[model samples]
Target: MTTNTTPPIPMDALRTLPTPELGMLLLERLGKETRFLPQNITAEARIAFKGESDEADLLDRVCEAWAWVESKALVSQVGTKTSDFRRVTTDGRKLVADPSALVRLAAADRLAGPMHPALEGHVRTNFHLGQYEIACFAAMKEVEVAVRDTAGLGHSEIGVNLMRTAFKPHNNGAGGGPLADAGAEGGEQVAMAALFAGAIGVFKNPTSHRTVTFDDPMEAAEVIQLADLLLRLVEKAKVREIKTENE
Candidate 1:
């Protein structure tokens, strides 16, 4: 659904300095003895080297490196917005001196919560940049694709109608089948059908058609998790159990 396959590393910079050397420079920029002021770092990073590189491009690489280390809590921003400064933590210095002290900072978790493995390729990539709506939409598209495949439906069957057709409960007079266990009491089947169909209608459609704001990553995570739950249910769909009888 989303083609965000860009690896979060600058290859050329890594080749030139390696992660350790680059990490140490970041530490130096952040100050080993004293805190580095935000203004000074920006000014220093923008100075071009021997006319071989652009200042802005170099600044971006430097900032990208810092963001990875900062996310790992190795560097902390001091003071309020007006008077911001950065200081390398003791752990940060350890990583600077010995980059192998721990696993790579770039390889660490991007968010506080665990991202579903299913979402890693597309959905979570968008989420990494606070693009919550895009992540939610990608996640829902994943659910739609999963349901479509599970139902043996063509691309023609889409959105809510596809969901309804696939999961519509068979009341002994149906042309289609249930998407979940047609339970002994029949209520579970009915509820499952409604849940899946409703989820596609409510969660998938709006995000697919419009720009729905999901302000926070927590909110986006919850929505993506909702799709995760529904997709797991779709995985349970099978033709043999499409018409289970009450026992």
Candidate 2:
């Protein structure tokens, strides 16, 4: 005789459930039993999700989701291992009151502080929805705007040219501005200019001029963090105002 094991959760539905939402769901069930186990949560989820979903399909997903919440400190564990667990944590309770709190907390951790206040809304909202490419695009756009506003450039100047003007090392005809001053040496200035310029040219420009799709949140988050770093550099950049004889 053969015994069948529970199958994995459906990837489609699992992906649809963001981590915070998953945590919230677990909190609802685990509330009934103050002290719980993975199997208990799994059984509860299977029953709740039945008819709407396959019973065998929910076990692994519920377990995986709960483990993540526990690891994140949103849920605490009791006895030794997965066999015994605890309910919602202080952090988890905060999320229950305000679902969006998880996104803010995550953004803070991912960014090591508040992301540029300007960029936070876009990053948090779309990121939770799995819209990684849009989040990255919006972030780079903030960098572009910051560079433009700092440089006193017009709308006509964009992409590579804008970055080149704002940060390129001072030369005979054209003098580099704030970004140039931010760098230690002339070469470093040029490189710094190129870094932001390249980021905008390669990432921002494409997204602005067309649609770009990114499937992996990790990859998109990397780019968003890069944009964050660039924005931070801009924030620290020293603007040198050149005064002519007229002034």
Candidate 3:
């Protein structure tokens, strides 16, 4: 005698069940457990779905919907443990309260802190989209490194013109891609240069306390680079020799 081994029930099967059954399954899995069932297969949501179904298909379709949410990789646990995020798709109850990654990103200030260790280090190199504007600046720096590495790219500094041009390739809503604010012209270098000058000025003349200002994007980018480089230098310097603000 041969023992039969069958694959698990497919989510698409859920559709075969009447509306009452489907609704109950959804509620049962989601913990809201309702008796209503929707038999209208012509509904936009049902019509759009394409997936395998399981017994009476109610339970299966619920899984299918959750699968759609998971495919976006934008799933997150809200009003609950972050560790529970992964459990959202397994059960309906979890998804009901889980919310989307976009939601979490919007509430990032309260849901979590800046770029927790859990964020992906690859791809976007960002923890959240709405509040992680620093990542945009960081991306510019990484791009600079990449350009430098390429033999023909000239390793140009991400000045205002270059920074704005960098975004030209992408067009989002309103014919322009969404992007972080690139500080005023002369850019990061200019800003950093001024900051460094201030720090240096402080050392040179402790009596003159004029505030430093950079009005150009290119200048700001240069300043940022200098500051970063100096920070690295300070990090490497001997304990007694370190005199920077962070030191």
Query: lDDT of all the models against the reference?
Result: 0.65, 0.69, 0.34
Q: What is the C-alpha RMSD of each candidate to the true structure, in Å?
A: 16.5, 10.7, 18.0
Candidate 2 lDDT tens digits, 1-247: 1123332233355657865566556665555455655566566556555654444445566777777777777667764556556666666776667666655556545654567676777776787666777888888888988888877788887888889888878765465665566326667877888898899988889988788987655667678888888888877773234432135
The sequence of per-residue lDDT tens digits that candidate 1 reaches over residues 64-83 is: 66666676678776554355
Clashing pairs in 2: none
How do all the candidates rank in terms of lDDT, highest first?
2, 1, 3
Clashes of 1: 0
State the lDDT at 69 in candidate 3. 42
TM-score of each: 0.52, 0.57, 0.26
Question: Largest lDDT belongs to which candidate?
Answer: 2
lDDT of candidate model 3 versus the reference: 0.34
Per-residue lDDT, model 1, residue 152, is 78
Where does candidate 1 stray beyond 4 Å?
1-117, 172-178, 238-247
lDDT of 2 at 96: 67
